[model samples]
Target: MLFDFDGPICHLFPGDTAKRVAEAQVRWLEERGLRDLLADGVREEPDPYKVLRAVDLRSPGSDLVAELEEHLTQQELGLVATAMPTAYVDPLIRTWSAVGARLAVTTNNSPRAVGRYLASRGLTECFAPHVYGRTPDLHLLKPHPHCVRRALDAMGAAPDETLMIGDAPSDHVAARAAGVRFLGYARNARKAERLRAAGATHLVGSLEPLLKVVYAVGDIKAR
Candidate 1:
């Protein structure tokens, strides 16, 4: 069995929310002339994720996040990507399925969000009835392992036969708690190191390296 989402199948889901938050922060900085205090030659298109994550930290007790969320609904936040599909995901799933691996998704995001993007990408039928999202599974969010456990149950997969790949620390941690091995899909190395610290058994900077895992090791070979 295989499990991976977020950076592998898609990029961060709240991309538009981050963009709005970054614009808001920039405006907030300019309003207070804080931009003037920065060193020279700092021009660059601001990364909305970094900008918003910083804001999220600066105002731990602030209602700003809720305010931001109110302005950016679930659908408003685009599931933007930093990379195109490394290879046709359908072939990978099909190959793995023939090798006896069942594929499924367990994401903290609302089920509708996944449906929305997959529908947009024309990749919905690939997963079949194996997606578990927060839409109706609110009680089983990530970092808790309930969703993954449910997936295992549905697949009739044992922990040893299951391999989880994800791009975040929570993804690996959740896999550990659910008793499975994990590979850190380090889409961004700096961020993925933190997940490594949390016990990601292996790291793949990009999906192109899957040939090594799926073919060479004969480990988790395509179904």
Candidate 2:
């Protein structure tokens, strides 16, 4: 199973707390006289990943882009203390692992941040050495299949046998590009609508349904 870290595993930012970081990145660019990188309303956009994407598109392969990405990664690492774990995520991870599933986190968030959270939650063993996340290259982040493809390659898992559960259209797109089954984990109606519009056929509002699936499979295995 390939789980997207931010939403499916936890609320990376509660109360849209990432806005400050996004604003900070914008401010950093502005201070460095890179104001031309700003798209309209970018300062007000809350998701730092989008900000990074904007900067990356305008300044790919530049040292400044690397600096900005590192800055954002630091911001993400700093925010891990307040990140809320998604309901049932810990047990779901443990249960799947117990049932012989090889899980990997495929996220746009920094792998270090994901590792920090998992280590804190004692989930490190559940997905050791398979956490594929942001690299220094911002363009590789999802909406591109780089991370997902990396995870699949690392696991030596076939696309037909893999499943990708994530909360965004980018996840859907990445999964499709990798030829993996896509499961949309929409926490609300707005997200559900977006996934639907993106052509996601498998949608779940919560992990509760997946828990049942996991337990059922485990039960059969035990039998």
TM-score of predicted structure 1: 0.64
Q: After superposition, how far is residue 7 of candidate 2 from its true place, in Å?
A: 0.2
**Top-scoring candidate (lDDT):** 2
Stretches of model 1 off by over 4 angstroms after superposition: 13-73, 76-90, 98-100, 135-139, 212-223
lDDT, residue 198, model 1: 80
Q: What lDDT score belongs to each candidate, Candidate 1 first? A: 0.60, 0.91
Candidate 2 structure quality by residue, lDDT tens digits, 1-223: 9999999999887775778788898889889889789788876789888988888888887898889888988888887888889998889999999999999999999999999999989999999999999998777889899998999999999999999999999999999999999999999999999999999999999899899889999999999
- Candidate 2 lands at a TM-score of 0.96
